[model samples]
Target: MTVVLALEKVTKSFGPVEVLHGVDLALHTGEVHALIGENGAGKSTIMKILGGYLAPTTGRVLLDGAPVTYHSGPEGEAQGVVVIHQEFNLAADLTVAGNIFLGREITRGLGLDHAAMRAATAELLARLDTSIRPEALIRDLSVPDRQMVEIAKALSRKARVLIMDEPSAALTHREVEALYAQVDRLRAEGVALMFCSHRLDEVSRLADRITVLRDGSVVQRSLRGEMTEDGMAAAMVGRELTDIFPPKDTTTGETLLEVRGLNVQNLVKDVSLTLHKGEVLGIAGLVGSGRTELAEGIVGLRPATGEIRIGGRQVQIRSPRDARAAGLAYLTEDRKEAGLLLDKNLPVNLTLSALDMWGFRIDPKREKAEMTRARKEFDIRAASDEMRTGALSGGNQQKLLLAKTMLTGPEIVIIDEPTRGIDIGTKQQIYHFVRALARQGKAVIVISSELPEVIGLSDRVLVMRMGRIAGEVEGAAITEENIVRLAMGLDREEEPA
Candidate 1:
């Protein structure tokens, strides 16, 4: 393998906070070097330095053993370097081919080379074995296809140094496999890749070498033969995850909520289920399979036609406010988008949902007391309850979301991707919390894309596929293979007698 790029003594700081401290890495041709760490562990910072988006305070970046400084955008682009962030830079109004050649359009004298750009994009998509039509508008494309378009755009730039951040974050398992195949192909073609991801298993499967960063410094650099998924995770967080999902006691109580003929577009179609008090009902599915949608619809976040009974009393929930008034709290999947008030203080978020329902409260002392207790109960680590929720880490943010909902004292709680973007230790904490809610006689519904989490947490698993209940498996009967098979509509077994 040929050494394509190198980072030496790369130190970076913003104001008084240093993000990277003498981080070193080397990427050889045909290499898939994975950089992984906690959310704020400087993975993105290092990538930005390499891609010329940000300059390091002190460092030497080398290409072919020769020191090369990256100062401006054109400099990195000219040297076969491109960085693809999780937030795709595609224009939704533009056509797919148009997005691929956005600023650097092929021109014919005074006009654009529309025919050539389309052809090139088509060729790139074909090479990646993607089914995205180059002529299709970006708005019409699915999330995975949009990602493919992003990859196509990077490839069109003649990129040899490709940095993909959380590339499979929104991808289904099958889409992830497709992406892995393309990454492998790109590697074989001598493209040096540094992929940053939270998915440790994916890094272990695809990366030729693994670099784990902890607190902005290199903790471990394991070669192909040395890295295991568990080892990578251990090195990344500097601790062993004894119980990713702590064991749960599954003795369920009385039925606290019941649903009948639940129908919602793109999410649920005639979905019927019952969530018992002191029991967890998990909705499991692949990405885009209506797991999150069902949760949102039931919580009145979307247009829905359904029968929901809380504690055997029928209630109509038209909106989120109505849902909360009816004793239902929903924790949305994307915390930044739906689950949090980033600008608000932690105490405010925790008490906001319950203030109207519980009684109009202007008592700062009581609110602070409640927030302090819940924070400790949920292990929400931050500077203070007065601190902005946005300033907290992913795990702390998730815990805060949970704390906010628990403060509502709802009879039914719906959590979508409860542990997403959180660490394993935090995940276990969340698992314990959900189980405790059931034990406290709250009807709990957990919607998760992760099969293990759903199976592990559920008293009964309801598998959703294409806006319908695919299958319902008893909690004890849940296995990854069965859950996936049922989720994909492969099983034709009768619903629990």
Candidate 2:
């Protein structure tokens, strides 16, 4: 293997705080190097340095066996290094072709070569087996499609060293398969790949070498077949995690939320479910299986035709506000866009959801008090209470969002992808919080793509397929095998009665 890029004893700091210390890594051509770490363990910081978005305080970056410096991200790209950020970077209002060609448009005569750009964009997307139109505005595409656009943009750069941050976080099983094929092709082409993901299974499958980071230092590195998922996780967190999930709540109370024959237009159809106080109901399914749409229907985020009963009384919920008034709160899966106002301060984002309680007037003192309480109670780790929500780490932003949802004082809470993109440590904290909510007699509904998460956290699990409930598993019967079978529409034998 030939080294394409190498970081030797890199140390990075922000102001007076040092986040990374003496970290060393190397990316080899035709190989995928997996970088694993808990949130705030300096994974993103290292990536920033590698992609030329940040400069290391100390140590050297070597390109092709010689020390090199990149003055800017574009400079690094010019040197055959490119990064696909975890967050979507496409301009929502621009067409897919326009976004892919932005700042590097093909020119014909005196104007942009729109035809050539569109043709190139189509070719790139087609290579990934995606059907997204080059002329489609990014804002109109789904989350998975938007992610494909990001990948296509990266592909257009003709990168020799590609750094992908959580590339499959928003993709479905089928989409992931397509991505895997693309990765294999890139590997065969001798491109060096640095893959970062919280999903340990993906690392196990794709990485030729695995590097585990803990507290900003490299704790372990192993070649393929040298480490298991459990070993990788233990290394990343620096502990043997015995139980990832908290003990399930055994008690049940009166039914707090009931949906009968709910339909969300063409997305979800005739879904019926019930949630009781002191219960954590898990919704599990493949992406595009309508699990999210069903939740949106129940929470009035999407228009629906059905009966929604809160506290055994049927109610009309025309919008999210109506659902909130009916004692229901929804935490969306896409926290960056729908859940948090990233540009605002913590106090503002924390109180925005429950502003009705403040009488429609801004109260700085009251808001500050609430923010202080939330930061302490939710274990939100940030530089200060005044820090912008966008500036906080992914895990802390999730904590603040959870805290914000709780501030509404709803009796029923529906949290979708409660811990997606969160590290194992933060995931444990979230699980604890959800269990605590159930113990307090609040009806909780958790929807997740990770099967282990669904089985670990829920007292009962509902599997959806195509637009309807496929099956239900309860108590000790809730297992990954059972859930996957149901999700894939496989036949299962009846248990001995």
Candidate 3:
């Protein structure tokens, strides 16, 4: 194998804090190198350096073993290096083919070649086994489709060295399989691939070589079969993580929330559920199964016709404000887009939901004091409390969001995709947090696409299929096989007596 790109003794610093510490990494042709780490472990920093998005403060970038400087990402791309960021970088207003060939379009007699670009995009999408049309606008695509588009755009670059960050984070199980197939094809084509993911199972399956990063330093590097998933996790967190989920709550209390005959237009139909105090109810399903839509409808984020009861009393929830007033809170799955003000500081974001508690005048001191409390309570780690919310790591941002939601002091909580893109260590923290809420006699609803998460966290699981509750599982029956069967509509028989 040839060393296509290498980072030699690299150190990166952002003002007073140095993130990378004399790191050394290399990518070889026809191989997949998996980078595994906790959030804030500097995985993103390393990827940025290798992809020429950021220059290393101390060492050199070696292209074919020769020192080279890339002033910008395009400079690196010009040399056959491309990076697909975890965040979608597509233009929402542009068509798929247009975005794929945005800067480098085929020209014919002083005009853009739309037909040729669309044909090429169609070929790329077909290669990825996707149904996305070349003429479709990016804004109309789902999260998984958007991810595939990003991958297609990178593939269009004809990159020799390709870097991907959390490529499967937004994809469903089937879409993930499609992505893996493409990855295998790329590897067979002799493209050097490096990707970071929170999903350890992916690393176990696809990686030819694995690198474990902890606290901005390389902790372990091994060939295939040298490290187990558990070993990689231990290396990343520097602890033996025996279990990630808290023990399920064995007790239940009075009914806190009930939704009967709920309908969210065409998206969610006739969904009904009940939440009891001191219990966690898990909603599990595939993407487009209407799990999120149901939650959004219940919380008044979407228009819905339903009979909602709080504390055995009927209530009308026309908006999120009404839901909040009725002692209900919702944590949106798309936290970056819908939940928080990315450019705002901590105090502002923290106190935005519960501003009524402070009356007409906003008190800066009280807000900062509450933020300080939340940092301690939720274990939110950041360089400074005054920093923009977007600058924090995914785990820390999630914790901050949890804290913000809790500030509303709701008796009923609905958390959607609680650990969507966070690291393992933070996931454990969140699981414990949910269990603690249950212990405090609060009713909680957890909606997730990860079956293991639902089985481990919920006292009872409701499987959603095409906008309705397909079936329910509880106790010893909440297994992946059972939930998947329900989500896929493979089983219609009643539960065993």
Query: All models: lDDT?
Result: 0.82, 0.92, 0.92
Supply the global lDDT for candidate 3: 0.92
lDDT tens digits by residue: candidate 2, 318-421: 88889889999999999999999999899999999787766788899999999899988899998888778998889999999999999989999999999988
Model 2 deviation from the true structure expressed as Cα RMSD, one decimal place: 2.9
**Which residue ranges in model 3 land beyond 4 Å of their true spot?**
493-497
RMSD (CA, Å), each prediction: 3.7, 2.9, 2.2
| Per-candidate TM-score against the hidden true structure | 0.87, 0.95, 0.97
Considering TM-score, where higher is better, how would the candidates rank from best to worst? 3, 2, 1
TM-score of 1: 0.87
Tens-digit per-residue lDDT, 1-497, candidate 3: 99999999999999989999999999999999999899999999999899899999999999999999999999999999999998789999999999999999998899998999999999999988889999999988888899999999999999999999999898898889988998998999999999999999999989999999999999999999999999998999999998788887458988999999999978888988889999999999999999988988988989999799999999999889899999999999888878899999888889998887567468888888899999999999988988999989999999999999999899999999999889999999999999999998889999987887898899999999999899999999999999999999999876899
Candidate 2 is scored at a TM of 0.95
Better of 1 and 3 by lDDT: 3
State the RMSD for candidate 3.
2.2
Candidate 3 is scored at a TM of: 0.97
Colliding residue pairs in candidate 3: none
